[model samples]
Target: MIKIGDFNKLKVKRKADFGYFLDGKTNNTKDDILLHNRLLGKNNINIGDEVKAFIFKDSEDRIAATLIEPKAKVGEIAMLKVVAHTKIGSFIDIGLPKDILVPFKARTYDLEKGEKYPFYIYVDKSNRLAATTDIDTYLTTDHEYNVGDTVTGVVYGFQTNNSAMIVVNNKYAGVILHNEYFTELKPGQELNLKVIKIYEDGKLGLSPRQNRKEELDVLESSIMSYLEGNDGFMRFNDKSTPEEIYTVFNSSKKNFKRALGVLMKKNLIIQNSEGTYLK
Candidate 1:
């Protein structure tokens, strides 16, 4: 049986003026997949020769065969680039002459052009190659992965509370909760994250936070450097909003305040309701 969107070892049924037709093994010549000459590369072939081919659909949605290995296959996860975005769906580059469709219904979030995201490739009901961002069904939590382990994840969706839904290493279910919010996040963004907590249901809670003391030191240096560059003073104080502080320092309020307290206790800066000033 010839499975579309996958590799198949098919015997060459016949030679055509344009290309060779690979037997689909369905006993129906009508189902014979085409292996175009341009796709043959450096391989020489003749009638009755068996060749391994990657089967997929062309721009006309007709079944075609290629010896070129695709970036991914059906039932596999791969980071695919969105080459085009349409109201109906997006198209992803699978390293083929024709890109694959990621239908709107197949995605958990709207995909943008030029953005790359991990997608679960599958053959839709129509037997057409398709991609999707909702990879939770393909994810697993049963593994040796543990808390505090450094991992990478791609932002895919958001929760009602503004938490980020993540696919850890494109395999495990993970989330960045609302409390761990930092800089702005968007779909298709790759983040180097840490496994902070594992829930009873086995869902992983992830964080982008670095070591606390080290983070404080970095934030302190960032602030002192900014103050020195900005005439040695800034009108910001501990009462400043986290958003404002983060905009200026790219740090959370907790780290910002801690750095300020450390600086103040050392008499390096003085603060009041109005503002903080370098002393």
Candidate 2:
């Protein structure tokens, strides 16, 4: 059965001067498949050679193929080696007769032949497979992601706002804000993170470390040290905001509130609704 918007395995039934004809018998409708020589090259495609091709509309609205290799598919991420560079784009040989085009706009840096680069494969408006370097714009899943769900990702680059570009699970690329990136990060660096938000678009928001119980303990100790350093009386309400808490403790306001709540409950500190003072 031939399916639209997908590749189908067809048997080469006959060879012609212009192309090879494939047979399709499904739903009692006989459809002729054309494997154009221009798209397939001069290679002799014999009868019964199972070829994988994507169905597309021809000039006459007939279902023809664009001759996609068995291995290549839409929404796939691959490490393809660059074969040639044109004025408009670079061509990658992803086991296809016609190398896939990675448009200049989709490229992050200059591509040279013999070098392998990771890219996401997608079908453009023209119904042709194209490669994109911007992997962040495409994400399509939503699982049970919590605030501290451990995740793994590769650092793509950085944003002007100091967010780190990361490809998580090769499913989607996302940003780990500079404030969220507590540790050092470099381009192409792979690290573990925690899920901050699972966006509606299926893109993930990430954080560097999971501020678990132990982490909170360390942060509480730091706050105590800061108070001790200030002669046991610290006026920090004016200075402690969400940003400051993140910068100093690598935690959120809720976490800080919880930590301070614990301290206050233990009578280690005193609060009078104005601010917290060391006791």
lDDT of each: 0.88, 0.70
lDDT of 1: 0.88
Candidate 2: regions farther than 4 A off: 1-6, 15-21, 24-71, 77-84, 108-118, 123-128, 182-189, 196-203, 208-279
* lDDT by residue (tens digit), candidate 1, 157-274: 8989999989876678889998786788988899999999998878889998888988898888988898888888898889999889988999888889999999988889988887
Tell me the lDDT of model 1 at 258.
Answer: 97
Compute each candidate's TM-score over C-alphas: 0.90, 0.49
TM-score of 2: 0.49
TM-score of 1: 0.90
**Which 10 consecutive positions of candidate 2 have the poorest summed lDDT?**
23-32
What candidate 1 gets wrong by more than 4 Å, as runs, is 41-46, 265-267
Against the true structure, whose lDDT is highest? Answer: 1
Winner by TM-score: 1
Kindly state the number of residue pairs that clash in model 1: 0
Return the number of clashes found in candidate 2: 0
- The 10-residue segment with the lowest total lDDT in model 1: 136-145
